[model samples]
Target chain A: EPEVTQTPSHQVTQMGQEVILRCVPISNHLYFYWYRQILGQKVEFLVSFYNNEISEKSEIFDDQFSVERPDGSNFTLKIRSTKLEDSAMYFCASSERDYGYEQYFGPGTRLTVT
Target chain B: AQTVTQSQPEMSVQEAETVTLSCTYDTSESNYYLFWYKQPPSRQMILVIRQEAYKQQNATENRFSVNFQKAAKSFSLKISDSQLGDTAMYFCAFVASNTGNQFYFGTGTSLTVIP
Candidate 1:
């Protein structure tokens, strides 16, 4: 089965620095999403992307966060400036369509902002 | 907004025994989906099973099965013949059927299968 892939299993950045998390979803998948989990906390939705644009986003997805499908395969989440509270495990997920119940999730990238 | 709740923080079962994790959700929409995901120490989210809200019959996957009661907004996962490898944190999730808006996830249940 095809799975979502993410690069840089771990990332460390200084406060106020920019960080871009990369993800390559399944080739034929049509929906992509970004979620974050603070240590020992529930996963929180950040944004969902489809048809080359954002479909929906949560309050946590403020101006500081931006998502773009720079290429046909690469989905990137850029954080304009990092904060201490921004540290968490970021996950990338994809599904064949917007209505599917199953979404393949990639091994999360742990971001540590100091 | 939909909210999934996993009231059990931790559970344990002996090897070869059966274990069930409880999950309850609040959603006004009748059409939706429920899922159970397993996350081990690696932190890789693995889909264990899924249940479509429209289906009345329960969903079963190998040793993993779900007791889905749509009217009560309850979905529970049962693991039979539990093994040491079955130890992990299980999360119950909810997603609307019409859109890829967001997934509402429960806090999580940590299960330990002891030999």
Candidate 2:
């Protein structure tokens, strides 16, 4: 089965530094999303993208966060400046259609800010 | 806004036994999807099963099955013939059909299958 793939399974960056987490969603998927989970916490929604534009976002997806579909398959989340609280497991997910709410999640990228 | 709730924080079952993880959600949308995802030690979120809100009959996949009660807003997962590999944190998620598929997940229930 085709699955979402994320680069840099783990990322370590200095506080205040910019970092970008890259993901390659399944080729035929039309909707993409980003979510994060703090240690032992519930996964929180960050943002959703369709047609190369954001559809909805959460409060946590503030000024520092931005998502881009640089190419047909690549969907990336960029953090302008890393904060200690930004350290968490970031997951990229995709679905074949906006109506098929069943999203397939990637293995996830662990972002650690020092 | 929708909220998913998994009241059980932790649960355990003996190997080869059965276990049930509870989940409930508050949503006004009539058309939606509910899912149970398992996060193993690798922390990879794996889809265990899914249930459509409109379906009256429950959904079953192998040893995994769901008991979905639309009127009660309840969706629970039952794992039969549980094995050690079933140990993981299970999360209940909800997504509206028309929206962009942004999920609202529950706090999660840590399930351990002891041998």
Candidate 3:
């Protein structure tokens, strides 16, 4: 089965530095999403994208966060200035229309802002 | 806003036994989807099963099945013939059909399958 793929399984960056997490959603998927999970915490929704625009976002998705579908398959999340509290496991997910709400998740990128 | 609640923080089931993880959600949307996701040590959350609110019959996938009560706003997962591989943190999630599929997830219940 086709699955979402993310690059740089682990990222370590200094505070205030800019970092981008890349994800290649499964081909043919129209909707894409990004979720974050602090260690031992529940996963929190960050943002959702469709038609090259954001559909909805959570309060945690503040000024520092931005998402882009630079290419047909590549969807990325960019943090303008990292903070220590931003360290968490970021997941990229996609679901085809016919599959209903079933989302295929990427293994996740562990971003550590030190 | 919707909220999913997993009252059980941790549960254990002996190998080859059966276990049930409790989940209850509060949602006003009449049409929605409920799910149970398994997060192993790898940190990737995998879909274990799903239940549509409109369906009266429960949803089942292999050893994983759900007892969904629409009126009570409850959705619980039951794992039969549990194995070591079933050990993971299970999260109960809710998504409204019209809400762009942004899930409201519970804190999660860590399930350990003892051998």
Candidate 4:
């Protein structure tokens, strides 16, 4: 079965540096999303992207966070400046339709900021 | 806003025994979707089962089944004849049909199936 895939399974960056987490969603998927989980916390929604624009975002998705589908296949989340709290497992998910469909998740990218 | 809650922080089941994980949600929307996801030690999020709020019949996938109580706003997962491999962290999630499809996940329940 086709699955969502993310790059840089593990990323380490300086506290003030910028970081980009990339994902390649299923080819036919129309909606994409980004979520994060602190080491022992529940997964939190970051943002949702569709039609090259942000459809929805959570309070945690502040100015520092941005998502882009630069190409037909690549969707990326960029943190303008990483904070220690930003260190978590970032996951990318996609669904074929907008409603009632299950979102398929990627293995996730572990971001570590020191 | 939608919220999912899994009250059990941890649970254990003996191999070949049956186990049930409880979940509850707060949502006003009449139409929505509930999901159960499994994350093993590998940390990959896997979809274990799903239930549509409009459906009265429960959803089952082999040994994995759900007890969905729409009126009570409860969705629970039951694992029958549990195996050692069933050890993992399980999360309950919700998504409203009219919303932007953002998933609301619970804190998760850590289940260990003992051999």
> How much of the real interface does each model capture, measured as fnat?
0.72, 0.76, 0.59, 0.74
lDDT of 4 by residue, A6-83 (tens): 989999999999999999999999999999999989899899998999999999999999999998999999999999
TM-score of each: 0.96, 0.93, 0.94, 0.96
Best by DockQ: 4
What is every candidate's C-alpha DockQ against the true complex, given to 2 decimals? Answer: 0.71, 0.70, 0.58, 0.75
> Across residues A1-114, which tens digit of lDDT does each residue of candidate 3 receive?
777999899999999999999999989899899999999888899998888998889999999999999978899999999999999999999878632478878989999999
Per-residue CA lDDT of model 1 for B11-87, tens digit only, reads 99999999999999998788888999998978678999988888999999999999998878899999999989999
Give the Å error, residue A42, model 4. 1.1
Which stretches in model 2 have alpha-carbon errors above 4 Å? B97-99
Is model 2 an incorrect, acceptable, medium or high docking prediction?
A: medium
lDDT by residue (B36-115, candidate 3, tens digit) is: 99989876788999888889999999999999988899899999999999999999998886666788889999999999
- Can you write out model 2's per-residue Cα lDDT over B1-115, one digit (the tens) per residue? 7889999999999999999999999988899989999989875688899888788999999999998989999999999999999999999998886554679899999999999
Pairs of residues at least 3 apart in sequence or in different chains that clash in candidate 2: none
Q: In model 4, what are the clashing residue pairs, if there are any? A: none
TM-score of chain A of 3: 0.96
Flag the better candidate by DockQ, 2 or 4.
4
lDDT of every predicted structure (CA atoms)? 0.92, 0.92, 0.91, 0.94
* Candidate 4 wrongly placed segments (more than 4 Å): none
Name the TM-score of candidate 4.
Answer: 0.96
